[model samples]
Target: MFRVSLLFLILGFTCLSCKSEDKNNVGTTEENIDALLQARYTKLLNYDVDSTAFPRSYSPEKKQIKQVPSKDWTSGFFAGNLWQIYKLTGDSRFKQRAKQWTAFLEKEKFNGRTHDMGFKVFCSFGNGLSVEDNQNFKDVIVKSAKTLSTRFNENIGSIRSWDFGKDRWQFPVIIDNMMNLELLFEATKISGDSSFHKIAVKHANTTLKNHFRPDGSTWHVLDYDTISGQVRGRVTHQGINDDSSWARGQGWAINGYTMAYRYTKDKKYLDRATATADYFIHHKNLPEDGIPYWDFSHPDIPNVSRDVSAGAIVASGLVELYKYTKNDTYLNYSKKVVNSLKTEHYILPKDLEVPFILDHSFGDWSKRHEMDEPIVYGDYYFLQTLLRLKEID
Candidate 1:
């Protein structure tokens, strides 16, 4: 009778439920996980998030899913996740869903108010193009790069990351800006145009020149005088302090540099990624389970929530770094991190069909926003890490 009920529940009329991790589970192997996630998503349809919009985070306080508009920074991740699932399972259902969700952002190909074009478009369209070779998607990516390039100033040598904070910042460049370069890099490669490539290289060089501390820990944001084209100051928006090694910032450093290396084959980028990874991995505050606290320098150690998002990003990049350097240590470390995530500390319950894959990630510790909850980007990066892990076979 329970199996009959479950079959009916898999149909569209029924909503899925959540499970706590302590409920005793199985399927730790990669193949097992692949089959499980595939079955879960295929059975569990529109409940993940608003099918019309992108998911941002779960508001535990509100006990609801949060969504952002098509123009928002996180808009691409939901569609990107669908495309990734399509790639993993070759399910036409997911592919069709990916196309439908991706279409919501078609207008954003030319929207230039924000610098997250890469995150907004490439993550959705780029991933789709990778598997399907769609020219329409290809054109949207090229146009998105052109739109993103409008924010680049030859004088400033980096794309502007924010439009707000005019009183506090003339031109703000955040380490998170590094993630956007991939769209431009792929644009240049596909279009056979070096313009986008030049912008990416310049942004990368400028970031490398100014963003890193001597120890490879990074300041989250750098403000430059828009007129003078020189740095004005450095600040931390979400970090514990102005000088602390914000865990996600360090993760971004390695992941972004590793991505730049993929396009440029520049040894400097890889070396920078390696240095940042070394700093993050060796930091004393990193937990024994391989998950990192919200910030390495968070004043209250052993009393803070961990950032599974950073762990996912770091592990995904390490898999790429392993390919570049052939270092078993990087691969081994990545495996450890992946293993840790599947552990109860991070993994969701086996029978549940929540949109989120992992939990206990800090959204923003300082603001008390969604702290110790499942994060949208965390789920995306976790999927990326799993996909990378499958490549070893």
Candidate 2:
């Protein structure tokens, strides 16, 4: 009897030991994942910066002494991504530099511009600066938001595009503008002004009516009839056209709508974001490396350049979608793209001179076609995605 009791006691202890071991293993796995994320987060915060306030893009090569004198909305997008990374990691350096960029945009030069104020200011100032609640930064954002709100046309119910030579396009709205609505929303929240929110919602609704296709692919540019208050034509300025999908433009829609859903909890925006994501994932043109070409329809173009920026941006949005839906598929897709980025082209292993992922990113087809260059937005999204993954794990 005593022997039987001893055997049963030993068996019970053995089972308990096995369970303990399993728990330990799981904890170790999670810890290792967190450590990996932390390392990558540190690397991203270390590199990626606006070399010059004048030109707000990534410059790994020290080619120009004077800050490259150009303005683009994509640079602002990258800065905004960096701000997000800082928010997750609590890294002070990221916050400081993000503030600096916001202050730079407060300049009279960049204030009321139209090409992609959402990418430029909303991401950088509206999202980036809002976390810290710095009064000066808030003031800068409010000013820019007011400027953007003024650009809204009552007739067309949308913001105008660039001030290119002629005022022919009175109410031209690009799909990219959908991302800018957050600035107006933030402005409304901070200033207690309802008009800002009204204008933002109107523009978002206008985009939903005209910018998206039946398949969820988005048009790059939409020209509106300011007098008639109607959409004139859907054209792709830097893309293939209204009929074709630009990979980056599609990415902007995915990220923009996901954000819209986050702020408003509107089911339509979430559905649109998912549909756009599905189009990107199932598209036949994805390269062997998992990064996509600049435009999905232009696959026949010889030596079609891959846009790492698109991959990074879409990956970040996918992770966000996963959070909302708890869909493992979205998480796995996001991981695959991020892993492809880390293993294949852009990611520097360690101890590299330049502080960016994916070398030779093309900014626009109009210039710098084949060259392997670093883009600011690529680095921004890459870092932002990494930080977000850390939070999830």
Q: What lDDT does each candidate get? A: 0.80, 0.65
Q: Can you list the residue pairs that collide in candidate 1?
A: none
State how far residue 53 of model 1 sits from its true place (Å): 2.8
Worst 10 residues of 1 by lDDT: 8-17
Per-candidate RMSD, Å: 4.8, 11.9
TM-score of 1: 0.90
- List candidate 1 stretches off by more than 4 Å: 1-21, 24-44, 48-52, 350-353
The TM-score leader among the candidates is 1
User: lDDT for model 1, on a 0 to 1 scale?
Assistant: 0.80
After best superposition, candidate 1 residue 31: deviation in angstroms? 8.8
- For residue 340, give model 1's deviation from the true position in Å: 1.5
